[model samples]
Target: MFLPTTVEEVERLGWKELDVILVTGDAYVDHPSFGVALIGHYLLSKGYRVGVIAQPDWHSGEDITRLGRPRLFFGISGGNVDSMVANYTASMKKRKTDDYSPGGIGGKRPDRAVIVYSNLVRRFFPKVPIVLGGLEASLRRFAQYDWWSDTLRKSILLDAKADLLVYGMAEKAVLQIAQTLEKTKDITSCHGIPGTVFWTSQRPENGIELPSFEEISQDKSKYAKATALLQFWTDPYRNVLIYQKQDNRYVVQNPPQLPLEQEELDRLYLLDFERRTHPYYARMGTVPALEMIQFSITAVRGCYGMCSFCALTHHQTTHVLSRSIDSIIEEAKMLTKHPDFRGTISDVGGPTANMYNSKCQRRETQGQCKKFCLHPAVCENAKVTHEDYLELLEKVKSVEGVKHLFVSSGIRHDLILMDKDADRIIKKLVDFTPGQLKLAPEHAHPKVLKLMRKPPAELFLEFKRRFESLSKTLSKKRYVIGYFIVAHPGESMHENDYLKKFIQRNLGYHPQQIQIFTPSPGTLSTAMYYTGIDPITGEEVFVERSLKHRNKMKQNVNTNG
Candidate 1:
């Protein structure tokens, strides 16, 4: 069932006030893919009256007060991305479109939306417990670097004046907060909860101390050092509490919550989701973001690849948790019944599509992994197989009214090479995909690939050759659509030229999906961007800071041969 949004809807449910209210920058979509919807529906299963305020007018209190006041707390999210990153381009210009907004509207959400929404809620209900979640809060739980302002900023909790911030996937933590607050009615005492960050009058003595806001703002090396330490402690099995002073109070981030086991993951996906945008936005126009994921299924979460530029490692951990096949099939069947279902399922994959039903050994989770799962070379301890995923796809195909199923998220080329029986997955996808299987090679140059923590250039080359041979055997037409990020740290004009030449020699064509790197918080690449040095080696690196040069790097990939 959809969460109650309007006061009339709440009244119709025979409710006086909501237990929790979620304020989001994007229009509310009642699908498992959207974080707010998953959490809202999950709360409903726990018997809480949850309401959502989607992209409310930040300038006024009209929409913010539509659902009265929440009894437990106000949950705020900057949608699926960091607001500044979402609203602005890498060159610091406003973006013309926001897929998450209704009608693909831009400027619907203000800059730093979590901070804005939390402060707005405070103006109306001064005593309400303000909580932050989603990418903005998760990545900025500690002191972070702000690309928009080109300055280091304090933890988002201090800027937002929020009582608490829950990072990572917050399903388990949100439930704990609701139950604990319902009983104690004291938000300040909400500490020792996993995956939560809160302001404390007394500094948390047991937690590891990081470079303070002032220190990070003053020294680049300090920021780099802090970023490495912060990432090191992300593993739930070996993390200690982290404390960093933002202002007068300390922001204490509790150790990350453990990944939900397979059964628990299945249950979360099996929750009753309406699987569409809240009807309140239906008349405005289509939400472009939904078009990408309305039919797609996220069969897994987290990534073990641990690329330096990617945030999955820092925010979601690199354990590569996944859902059960039964749960995925049931969801796919439900989609056939969806009103918009065209007898096709857009995707059934995750951070890495092939990683589904495969995971690290028991000892791999005891602490942080010492090596990347697919970088340099596939780790010896890594489990590489695709039999279970192939079986799941077969079950999905057998579902009545399902005409087509595609793994559109991405197919890791390196993983494809690692799997001894990679031909089956490639053959199936070549037949399923119209012309291409999406792959993120990121860069073709070795130095840039080293900075990216991705596999070497030879892997993509080998995968391409194998793909050609397999497709020739079937007499089918398909190729890899490579995604590249240019102007990354350690990548100057020299690497861009190298990338241009590498693509010309190997693929015989320039890629279309190319972009300049944006130094976002909670990424090792961003740390490198800020420090102008490799965090691990402390060696100077080339960082492209000029807008003109960065723009040139983007164009290098689009010039077809």
Candidate 2:
């Protein structure tokens, strides 16, 4: 059943007042893929009366107050994607459309949506506890580089005046908050919970203090150092507590919540999600995001790719969490019963489809590995395999109503190349992929790929050759579509030229998918973009700050210059 979004829906559910109200910047889709839905559903599963206020009007208190006041706390999210990224492009222009919106229109959400919604709720219900989560809050939990403003901003918790900020996949932390508030009746008592950040005047003992916001904002080198330190201490098992002084108060971040056990992860996806946007939103128009994923299933939760330009590690962490096969097949069987089921599962994977069941026992015993897991070389301790994933897919396909199951999520090419059973994996992926296998090689130049923490270009080429050969052997016509990034932190015109030549000499065609680097918050690449220094190696990098030059470099590569 869908979580109540309106007071009428709440009343129909026989609830006098909601225990928690979730505010988001996206149209409500009660699917597990959406964070707000997943969290709202989880709270309901625990017997809390939860409601959602999606894409409320920030200009007035009317829309924000429609659900009335919650008995417990208000949860705010900047939707699935960050507000700044949703509202603006890489070149910092206002985006004309938002996929998560009712009609796929832009301007439905405001800039800094999390902060805006939190302040809006505070204006109406001044004393209600406000909890912030989702991509925007998670990535900005620490003071980091803000690309749109070109300034280092303080943590979103301080800017939003939120009582608590839940980072990463926040199902566990948020439930703990609800439980704590139900018993103690004081929101502040919920501080120091795993996966939560709160501000305190007293310095936290034994906490690793990052460079203060004042220090990092002024000194780029210090900012890089802080970024490195925060990432280094991200493991939940490590039990590292980190804090950074904003001004007078210090923001203390407890160690992340441990990866949910298989049973715990399995239960979250089995919730009775309608798998469609709420009727209220459906009447407005088709939500583009929902349309794409309503038929898809999230087979996994977290990723361990740890790419420099990606924020998956900071938000989802480097842990690769997969649900049990029986649980996934159960969800697949349920999907077939839905009225909208068309016998095809659009996707059955997470951040990286092939990373399912990929485990690193060494990292679990000893904290996060100091070495790169998949960048320069796949670490020996990192066991990259596809046996379990292949079995999971085969079982899902064997479901009575399931006809076609596609692995649409980006496949880590490095993993496939490193796997011992490469032939079987490639053949299965070719059969599963509709036609084009999505691979993100990022760039061809060695220095730029190194700065981006991507594998050597030669590895990608070898994988492509094997994949295309397998497609031919299996009598399927399939091709590898490469995703490239131009003008990243270390890429100059010379490096971009190398990328252009590589495309011409290797692929023989200008690949359609290419993007200019945006340098968003909470990414190692963004730090290098802002500081012109790689934090890990402490070496200088060339950054293209000029918009014209950045655009020209992309144009040159696209035009096959």
Q: Largest TM-score belongs to which candidate? A: 2
Off-target runs (Cα >4 Å) in candidate 2 are none
lDDT (CA) per prediction: 0.85, 0.90
Instruction: Put down candidate 1 lDDT per residue, 243-289, tens digits, no spaces.
Output: 88776778888998888888888888888887788889867888988
Q: How many clashing pairs per prediction, in order? A: 0, 0
State the lDDT of candidate 2 residue by residue for 163-245, as single tens digits.
99999999999999999999998988998689999998999988799999999978899998999999999789788999999
lDDT of 2 at 161: 92
TM-score of the candidate numbered 2? 0.99
Query: C-alpha displacement of 413 in model 2, angstroms?
Result: 1.7
Residue 6 of model 2: what lDDT?
Answer: 81
TM-score of each: 0.97, 0.99
